[model samples]
Target: MKKIIFIFLLALSFGCSESDSASNDSTGQGGSLAVFALKDNYLYSVDHMKLNVFSLINGEKPVKVNDIPIGFDIETLFAYGDNLFIGSRNGMFIYSISNPENPTKLSSVQHFTACDPVIANSTHSFVTLNSNTTCGNNTNVLQVYDTKDLKNPKLIHSRNLMQPKGIGFYTAKYLLVCDDVLKIFNIENPSEPILVHAIDKNCFDVIIRDNTLFAIGDKGVYRYKMNPNDIKDIQLESETNF
Candidate 1:
């Protein structure tokens, strides 16, 4: 159980890949739920080599629609506007979901074998690679890319991290990274992100809604009240053990 917690912590803190249509922005609202992503009336799931598509038209029950074969060791899933990002140990894959039932591959950026999860808004995407027992011989760093062109994502810059896990966008201006510690950065300038504040706490993943921040780690579920005026003024509202 301890081993599972450690692994979960590592995977949760980095970032998760996502996909969604522009019409439905609420599907990928939280960063912590990485395994599954929703777009319109469909839900996509990844398990090793297969991308499973399910229709939520019935809402209560998921109807299996299609099973698309993908690369090995798929780690996370994220839904951006009209696009789905798949994070495999080998690289990042982007898919167009104009037809949610049948997603087509647009492009992919290959990287060294590592544990990676990605998150993005409309313009930029963030991917973090972490070195772990499962991820062999990989350097830990945060890679940022310009997603202006869906077919061709350009790598703009990268920032080295100790061990990055789940990442959250507080706004277009601020980003939260969970690793050995919780670090928030001022990304007003996406190309040059500056670390504004950090907490000496081990964190796995985080999600921000309105003015509240939710995070989970070995300690348990954590909740905080966020102050946009001062990123450093985050107040711990409550905590519960798992």
Candidate 2:
């Protein structure tokens, strides 16, 4: 029942996504939509279905280096090793970021209607098929690819799940999936991911703080007991932010 409600809420909010810069117009998630890499300050995320690259530190204006067209329902942005990757409704899109001012679109691969926003790693990208796709109804599968060669990626593995929901990767080995329960899988072997653990309630996006894991749930953002070793030990610590 809780899972159903989340799906409905997320689906209902899709139509609100729009294009046009925030300064030029007034639309989108009210300029709150954002994604950024704590490691790289050169790239920043924008709500209007594109990414902004800083030409210079503290520049007067950020440039829309990548033109993905906001109306396409893009939700996530990740930049790693001179490349940028985005998660859209259709699939995952890869771009070359040799020049911060101009990001080149390398490819757009189709999958399911992905959402709630995540990128596994700059080298390994993952997306949750939140809902069904035209190809077939979603059975909750996480697509894991060998992006070592960005230009021509190889489909390394697919972890089929039930309502993959949102995802977060700690060391490119463990994939924490959000759903009615928190599902953790050890992808030490991407081709054959092994189940690590599962717990009840909501788990959306997850992050790391010191040795703890921060998870985003329907209620709010909270801390979790994340063991680099054991998944069964994971337990909620305290609520932080949503």
TM-score of each: 0.88, 0.71
lDDT of 1 by residue, 13-36 (tens): 333223121233546434633767
The list of candidate 2 runs beyond 4 A from truth reads 1-41, 59-71, 113-118, 132-139, 240-242
Local distance difference test scores for all models: 0.78, 0.56
Q: Write the per-residue lDDT of candidate 2 for residues 110-181, one digit (tens) a residue.
A: 765555344544456666666535324544666777776677766777766666666655555677777657
Give the best candidate by lDDT: 1
Q: Pick the candidate with the highest TM-score.
A: 1
Question: What's the CA error at residue 235 for candidate 1, in Å?
Answer: 0.2
Output the worst ten-in-a-row residue range by lDDT, candidate 2: 24-33
What global local distance difference test value does model 1 have?
0.78
